[model samples]
Target chain A: MKQRTEERMDQDLAFLLRYENIAWYEDGVVKILDRRIYPIRVEHVICKTYAEVAEAIRQMVTQSEGPYIAAAMGMVLAVQEVKDRTKETILAQSDEAAYALSHARPTTSRQMQAVVNDARQVIRDALAEGCFGQALVEAVHAYALHYLNEKYQRYTRIGQRMEELLPQRATILTQCFPGTIVGTMLRACRQKGKEVILYCAETRPYFQGARLTASVACDMGADVTVISDNMPAYVLMNKDVDVFLSASDVITRDGHVINKIGTFQIALAARYSNVPYYVTGTPDPQHRDTSQIVIEERDPRLVTESMGQKITMEGVKGYYPAFDITPPEFVSGVVTEKGVLSPYELDRYFDE
Target chain B: MKQRTEERMDQDLAFLLRYENIAWYEDGVVKILDRRIYPIRVEHVICKTYAEVAEAIRQMVTQSEGPYIAAAMGMVLAVQEVKDRTKETILAQSDEAAYALSHARPTTSRQMQAVVNDARQVIRDALAEGCFGQALVEAVHAYALHYLNEKYQRYTRIGQRMEELLPQRATILTQCFPGTIVGTMLRACRQKGKEVILYCAETRPYFQGARLTASVACDMGADVTVISDNMPAYVLMNKDVDVFLSASDVITRDGHVINKIGTFQIALAARYSNVPYYVTGTPDPQHRDTSQIVIEERDPRLVTESMGQKITMEGVKGYYPAFDITPPEFVSGVVTEKGVLSPYELDRYFDE
Candidate 1:
């Protein structure tokens, strides 16, 4: 059976929070991180330990939070299966698992932080509830899985609420990866059987659109066309792209989003064309409120150097600015793990 | 016989000054205006009457005064070849011819203006020398040819002197069609047997470098590479191009040279690389003293439109700025009809 949009959103969120192995395993099925080729294939590369799970993520075998965290949860379950009885041994193993898995890729640190925090919380909560040994382990596993499902339910609620904010069959232009947050939202729309067409930007330096997001939309069965960054302003000027949606690597507490450099120009064009633009990111205290957030400065040589199977020499100096900060005023809305927050509702999103 | 740099400069300058047919009769060969290959290649058009000459010029069938003016000289001679008593008819025909020719192309009005002015002057000079009828026609034709040849000689001298200023075997990056101007300057150096490799920019909106200048340089046996304008700054920043040469469409009496937009950027890069930049143009009264000169704005849609042959239904707008003004300070020297003028010699190039 084809997974409806609501089903995908539920699956993504549930997958993000769950850790137990199930007898009913599916291959060529949908996963969160690598959205491009999901549902069509549900093949699972099972690993027996946390180290093994870290290796999968380091190799980018499992990509987005939905799959990545799901894989992380599997690692936690693997640790529990072979873990020592003593608290010190378990704590040490948990730290090792979290550090190894977190550094596997440049990811939303919040995902790993949240999962590790939850694992620790489950242990404490189980002990406080007078659960111990095998019972404690069973309770923790069940709680982790339940939390994952709860996040999925929240996504559905958010997606349903956002539907009222969006028109039927809206045309959207997306930059970078929108994560499972917007994916869930879109999935929710799909469950309702809404039609949408996505114009994807072939984001440069790293072709996130070409490599990641385009396929995610494609997997979700949204109409998608990938174009170069230089072509966006022209497209925005001529085509009737109604909405602009993008994922943010960093969002400050005050609601400022730091995204790709050309994103600002795209936002400028969208503003000129009267298109609504949105940015989404997961929020956590460790992820720094607005002031402590730092933008990444990459090597300028990356711009001049061509990235192909083999390196080629280009006889010109190139200037590459990686990130641009979009003013909150220009943003239409902000989506978070908690909910889809309005650009003006920073206080609400970060209130906790 | 191999022409010396001095003789070539003189011939080129003389070619710039006179109408083509007379110049052709005196030199025994027609100088072709290759720029007329635009829109379509129509008649293997030649000018025999001043009216026909101006119209050909107005139509840009004859382009670039350095050569077309010589051809126009030939046309004046052709008119003279007609019945001696019909000289009055030729004179009348020439004015009407010039007026019609002036409307052919937009911008760069100097070439046609030179033709009309020289034809009328030759007529007046002939009538003044007590020459009448056939003698008057012959006198006018001979005088026009001599005038053209002398102008070419003077320009050749300027080119020769400019050659000494540049190193032999240098790599040069140049903007726009300097063929009749600094292009002739480089040809003068070739007459001296200097080796130079030219990196020519593909000036857009009109692919002047790709279509006109590159072919001219190649035809004249200059070592040349045509690259798009987008590629130059990087190439210059990394590649060891020794010099930059650009020709301006307008030079105000104050000495600012206005040429293609990216010229300024090219100049900036050349300066950063410690390479000398040169601007060349004919210093004419109609180019006007600074107070009266007007810089024409080319279409901006050229920037907004797609350059490739195939059209896509979706894409963003592009920006195309036709010309940019280069401050005299950034230019090492300006080559004109008379001599190579330094920025400080603005008063000398024009005495307005």
Candidate 2:
């Protein structure tokens, strides 16, 4: 009965929301869907080694939760490369690969580190059981596939919980590309015959919201409109926005939600207008407060130019801080797989 | 002595801030500096008739205070075209020109209407005084030049008053192209040997901040950095932003400010962070409240594309409202030619 239900949920997801479509390891190579040119053109960046996969993450070929999955597949590549070597050599090389993949981007490093560390532990257990050479590689590869499936299942449940918290008819405002969870939530809304209007803020310096989120929502047959990052406050004040939802890169233990650069401004406007703001993600106990979160400042040229065409003058510098922190006061709740928890009551998430 | 001081101020202005550089009437043609491709390429859109000038305004060849001057020059073109005809014909044509120029764009219609009306009134007086043909054309032409000079002088005073309110050494955050007023304020700071760091939000859909404001500020020798519109709240929170300044399209008698779409978000963030928000513009007694303000919804294609390239998937819609409103409670003060006054105390301006 559980297997049938899981298969039904998998069939309901949008094309880009599926695990195999985002990134997959097969035939000793990893292929990641290139998000930069997605929806315009369907393509993938082929990675023969774990180093190539790490480079792809740094280049932002895939973003949001896409990187976390790519990091796990990268560890599988690392195991495949040295399957004929001794166990000690394979473990040392895999540790190096894990470090490189986690350090690809600073803002999402916490999740990426967790994914790679779990993969390495699986490899260690398989080797201690007297599995050598190709058998050990097979063991890690199987572990990676299972890890991806478990994450998808967890998010599916979170999506159903999120849909329950929403109204029967809702006008939603969101920022950045929220990845699979939003797609699953939209699918859940359709399943229940609920009406939803989505407004997406076109995240700048990387048109992630415009390119990634809009495409997925459009494929799911949801009513969606793309807005520039600056329009969130205007839309919240003038339009009938039932809720402001977003996916966070990391939520600190103190309940500060950090996501894209524009999320904080939206949270402020949402709070002022009495609209509740909710973020979907689990809390990172490593970050006790926002002070520990490292915001990645990408290349200023990305902000200064659009499609390789310079928007501003030659000498004027551009500032592009990849993310911003929204204090707990602005957040109404954090939706987790367990349930919707209050921002101040995050400790409830770890009680189990 | 007053004339010498005015000349010194003109010399101190940046090239783009000068009246002639923005828009001017010469050789029976009105040349408007094309703001859409400014700083990247210094070019002008030539208007051979009043109709062409009005069309230029609609197309956004010039913006902010630039349109006010363009509308005045357009009236000059009308007078010259019919100077050889009957007085009745000339007056009729001038009135028609005034209506067309003012109605070019809705948001700034009040200012444009006042400018063209003032020009027509000057023509009525010139004709009544027996000035005819070339003499009548010359009379209206001279009025336009004097009117432009008076406006420059008025904004110069507003700039000086704004400088007085700012700290000696401070960091300032601004949105959209503030036009000549910001240029003059920076000059005033330089004259006083005060340090200032300016952060410009690269306002999207038009990039008025990136292409226009940053160019002008850099030319004036101020320390300036261009950031995407989404980065304002982050900068306000993390950086030492002492003041948040912007230029408004119109301010209602109830103290509501209507400006670029992103201004309200910045104001909300500024108020939250205890940074005073100041806007430079005269209040319109005509608008009783925000309900009287018309927020122009522009073409969605403008927001969906960047540099003529589509950023999102096909079939997805974009929402582009050119302006938003900031309530009086969020505003710290309104900087006018008279002085900086409390938002609630706007009636003090008309006391004289």
Best by DockQ: 2
- Per-residue CA lDDT of model 1 for A1-352, tens digit only, reads 1223223224533232222321111231112233222222334556555666666665444543444455446534544654446665655666666666665544345456666666766666655566556665555456545555565565556566555456788777877655554556667777777787777665544445544565556655667666544345445655688778776666666666767655655665577568888776644445445555444444445442223211111222233445666667778887655666766566687576
Evaluated against the true structure, the overall lDDT of model 2 is: 0.87
DockQ of each: 0.04, 0.76
Cα lDDT, model 2, residue A170: 84
TM-score of each: 0.48, 0.96
The stretch of ten residues in a row with the least summed lDDT in candidate 2 chain B is B1-10
CAPRI verdict (incorrect, acceptable, medium, high) for model 2: medium
In model 1, which runs have C-alpha deviations exceeding 4 angstroms?
A: A1-3, A6-352, B1-31, B36-43, B48-52, B66-71, B74-90, B101-106, B110-115, B128-140, B180-194, B219-222, B285-291, B296-323, B336-340, B349-352
Root-mean-square deviation of candidate 2:
2.2
Q: What is the two-chain DockQ of model 1?
A: 0.04
Over the stretch B13-100, how does candidate 1's per-residue lDDT look in tens digits? 2222223322254332244343434212322454455455545554345444433454345445444644355556766655654455
Instruction: Tell me the lDDT of candidate 1.
Output: 0.54
Q: Candidate 2: lDDT of B233?
A: 90
